[model samples]
Target: MAAGKQVMVIGADDSEESHYALEWTLDHFFKPFGGDTAPFKLIIVHAKPSVSSVVGFVGTGAGVLPIVDADLKKMAARVTEKAKEFCASKSVTDVVVEVMEGDARNVLCEAAERHQASILVVGSHGYGAIKRAFLGSVSDYCAHQAHCSVMIVKKPKTQH
Candidate 1:
């Protein structure tokens, strides 16, 4: 309690795999970090593409900003809400929710740096090695970019 709690910046999005990762992380890491005696800070980080990313397509049309802003804002709020529900369901306390605007990899890394996280955790989308080569993986990018150690959790395969 006296010492500062270590931060674990988690990258989340709107996907079943991401939820699986959250559950996996809570099952494995939460006990060690957020045990009954002491709890470490758990930060849920979600990234929403910035409106500027759409500015070119919108062409600065009238009412465009308002519509885009509302949609983006609502999506971000939903993401954070989902995070909160998940944390509560897991009985996780000492949790922080951050909804950022930008590329997922960049926002997540920036959050880790800002929070001075000891470790960063993200879920693998289960892309094949060949596909991963063609389409860069977020978890891979984060592993390479994050300042601290990274954990990439993959969803368990479902039985037919």
Candidate 2:
């Protein structure tokens, strides 16, 4: 693996599965290639729903829109902090945390392309075939569309 390669980790709503995937990438991929001798750049991407969707549904009528700006900022900050911690633990010197507004899959793929990422890492929700067919899966789309390699970390299943 080449040093200083760009790796992009797609983060969701801070779910346990996403956290696990982040940790796994840090442990297995970033840490191995990140240090004084082996330096790598890590970019954490968090996708928020686009405001256009909301505006499209709800017209700009004269009404007091409950702007939860503080909440959004807090959530973004939390994600950034978590990503920072992971990078720090793995000794990744160059790290960036980006909170973008768009659909998850589209944002992730776009970021991967824009960054010319060597690899894209994302968490799998483990939705069944039916669910995936109906709702689509970000990991699946990214794996197919990304210009670079893609890694998906799925949550451990419970033993029945």
Candidate 3:
């Protein structure tokens, strides 16, 4: 299949699974679509940790520390650098990086909608059914709610 005009590669965090998915999409999916030959854009969307959640739990016996805006900014810079390297290596053109605070699923969906992205690419953290059923997986939620097509990539298991 041909590649989408605008593709949002969500979740460029420090997770190995996310990195794997990002690389895979760039190498296999996007590259095959002609790399820089096509007039397409790659947008990297990262989620910032919730400060309000931390504040809400404060003085309530919750030991969680509020993630400062500076910390989030630093993390976003790293993610942007990694994304740029990935895109440059694959020769992707017109790449952009976006970092925002609040829920991951919500941010991803909103970005996709705003960009009019033809597809959304994300990685699975391999959460178990029990946990996913309770908390819900970001990939699962995006797949269900996103207006565009969604692709969920999982890390390959290593054989012993």
lDDT (CA) per prediction: 0.83, 0.75, 0.78
List of clashing residue pairs for candidate 2: none
**Candidate 3 on 16-129: residue-level lDDT in tens?**
988998888888767886776654567888887676654664543434343454566678789878878878878775678888787889889988898888888899989999
**Considering TM-score, where higher is better, how would the candidates rank from best to worst?**
1, 3, 2
Residue 99 of model 3, lDDT score: 86
Which pairs of residues have clashing backbones in candidate 3? none
TM-score of each: 0.85, 0.79, 0.82
lDDT of 1 by residue, 7-31 (tens): 8889888888888888888877776
Write candidate 2's Cα lDDT for 26-142 as tens digits: 677656655534344567898866545555566755352334444555777887787777667767756678888788898999988888887888999999999999989999999
The lDDT-based order of candidates, best leading, equals 1, 3, 2
The stretch of ten residues in a row with the least summed lDDT in candidate 2 is 61-70
What's the lDDT for residue 8 in model 3?
56
For model 3, give the 10-residue run with minimal summed lDDT. 58-67
